[model samples]
Target: MNITTPTELSWIILLQSLIPSYKKRAERDTSVPDAANKARKFAQRYGEILESLKIDPTCQGGPLDIILLCKLREQVLREVGFKDIFKKVKEEENEKAISLFDNVVRLNDTIEDEGKRLESLVRGMFAGNVFDLGSAQLAEVFSREGMSFSATCQNLVPRPWVIDDLDTFQLKWTNKSWKKVIIFVDNSGADIILGILPFARELLRRGSQVVLAANDLPSINDVTYSELIEIISKLKDEEGCIMGVSTSNLSVANSGNDLPVIDLKRVSQEVAYLANDADLVILEGMGRGIETNLYAQFKCDSLNIGMVKHVEVAQFLGSRMYDCVFKYVEV
Candidate 1:
């Protein structure tokens, strides 16, 4: 969260970062008969928002940050008559991820070594991070390959990580268990279904209560409470779920945010109440875990998981694109 340079918050630079994906409406649905027209109208409105922001003489030469950008995006999307532009996309992603989730979990259960099994699951979190909206071009270009997504994720490995403290996290949590865990989720596709859900279930296996904290509304492709509930409801009906964690042991809490950025100071009553006993808080994705809460402090153990997806963020963190971070701290 250090302010290293003014360009880090430059409005123009941030807009440029999103231009390509916005132009084509990355991962957009054109399969339906009228879906193309719907997408076109949506994109037109989106472009109008961007244009308005650019022409705003008052906003000239302002310092741009991720939180502000996200807020602006949310506001514009709402005003444009589409509160959830990714509603269809999110649904598709959730469905695809849930369909392949059994295999994702099966791979981990096959690993005989306990530590390795845990490590593989942790890596799954990083691998699934490719589903980010900022990197939606990558997702769209590659196509959401469902069960075959794992092979694409393998490319993420063998890359230098910016902050890798998995060994330390394993050292502490392998034989120990926390009373409660707060899994701050991100993205709609495999990122949540294949990554955080399995990780949370593993915590459940160790007798930890889990609170899946998500957005109160929509922002980018970040999962919202409505979207998360849909996914959870599906998992509940599955027989012999991974780790056999009951759906009752899992709870959902809104973080009281409509944007991708998290403002921990104002969480929902549910999250505030559940987090009281939270000994482990896992903040996932670059927006929450890095941009806003990179230096966030708490009265308990915390873990920040993210993949550097944007150039500015990579430069700010002194990492490269797709570089993963596994930062752990106890306070």
Candidate 2:
């Protein structure tokens, strides 16, 4: 008698889960929905692609990376408007590069109106609820308070409307005791800076361990692990030095008050070492769709965490990177 190996069993279980089935949510009536079917189809297609690439989804990389990829794939599904098994559009569908570039140029010019034109465009591409919290003008005008025009402009015209809160989600985790926070970093841009800085601050304040998982520089202007190391090396005190960890491919100098950096490739091993005594894990998303799609996939396989679809982000991007994360939610 041949007993199934763990690897074989895992594949079987994964395949079985991918098959369409009825699902019932907690505190909800039991019913069969196409969500499962959609997920199954996506899985199948994804599996095919991975197979073609000769990569085993289960073991091509660390679980953390896999999880990030899953999260990213989910974002792609949303952006491509393929939430159902019946309707799916690949990026190649819009591979008209020159035309897309023209549209982007047009998008930049259309934001000139700031208040009306920009809002309208966002609503059109991402739906009205994208800014349900309120438009950029919903808050106090900092421009009138001696802030620089550039600062005010950046704030009001966020690239991806993660939320005003995201613009300042910083915290101190001194008493929180979190093990690590994963940052799914994207390009170095206004949105990426706005989304992560605040979150890092808050995590530091709460004393939660933090990990900024980002690609190696210099793809995104956002902080890379290598860059972070230099910054930490010169750290003097904790006042302005928000502490966390960054993952890239370089060693960073840790002077206690500043955040540390880790190579992305070694994330799993580093995480295992840290998780033995931490409180929470935070994953920061890259501000771009491709990065987000990759992050989603990695998160699913590794952490099993749900990535929030920031609808406003898609509206803010105005359709260039439509499925970046914010496009999936209902308006």
Candidate 3:
């Protein structure tokens, strides 16, 4: 879908902020002797790597940088499984002296193996380094502007997504007879807001049902029915249309004009009615805290939706997280 709104871009910006914070913590924690010892042992066991790179201690850099290097050294040692003599740098007798000696040796060796630089060495150790994933990786898909993902993660910088990335939403739902479509929504981020609106309009056009599943209140960027209305307000102001709004179980219903709201949670009968009658089901989740999908899973399971097939879609922001889309097939 063409993500053509500034609001959609906001979603990218919000998520980008998380990468640097995580990386900084990772770097800072690397200095701990207990953790460092394990890391060093991991490195030493992979002897060929250390031998090839020749790391050194006398290299001039910030203390934090040096500590991070030490952390990398420790990681290398542990990865290769050298259990014996893997001592925490501070705990050892003559800690400073020992560190100095080790640093000198690493520095000399590292200079000799210029091609196998410390950064490259550490990067190789992780196979896929965390920092690499956040900046260049995530920015490629989400941030079209000249957003530096690498620098952001390394420096712990924050950036917000533009609204455009979220403008157009696509919902794919099918009935046994191919007569309907449904849109499931989770977060109230600009991306989802923009995406869902377009998707909802399209579903209505096709005579299908569009359901938006969100929490009762706003938690971070995830929206509530009120917030959804606010988005609708902005969209209506900009585009002059509010044609295909949902009224399914997940759709918000106002009990009174004074306060535009609905029961944050819909009834089981309502959900079942939508599920049974739906040619397809789109289940969205709440964004912050615990995910809404976990609750939805229980509901789907209770409804005897049968075997749930999970599809891992993408790994964003250098994280090990897998973005999943699931399919439940009825036997």
Which candidate has the top score in lDDT? Answer: 1
Report per-prediction Cα RMSD to one decimal: 4.2, 18.2, 24.0
lDDT of 3 by residue, 1-331 (tens): 2222332223223333433322232333434556444444443343333232233222223222212232333344334333222122112212222223323223424444323332222212111111121223432333233222223223321112211111111111222222333333333332243234444554454455455444343222234455555555554423454432333323542211110111224433444455554455444321211122222433221111111111111222222232222233221
Q: What is the per-residue lDDT of model 2 for residues 12-86, given as tens digits with 9 covering 90 to 100?
A: 333234222211111111132454454455556555544432334344333323233334344434433343221
lDDT of each: 0.74, 0.31, 0.31
lDDT of 1 by residue, 236-310 (tens): 756635546665677888888887768788788888888898898989998889878988988999999988876
Q: What's the TM-score of every candidate structure?
A: 0.84, 0.31, 0.32
TM-score for candidate 1, please give it. Answer: 0.84
Candidate order by lDDT, decreasing, is: 1, 2, 3
Q: Which is superior by TM-score, 2 or 3?
A: 3
Those runs of model 1 whose alpha carbons end farther than 4 Å from true positions after fitting are: 1-5, 8-11, 23-64, 139-148, 238-243
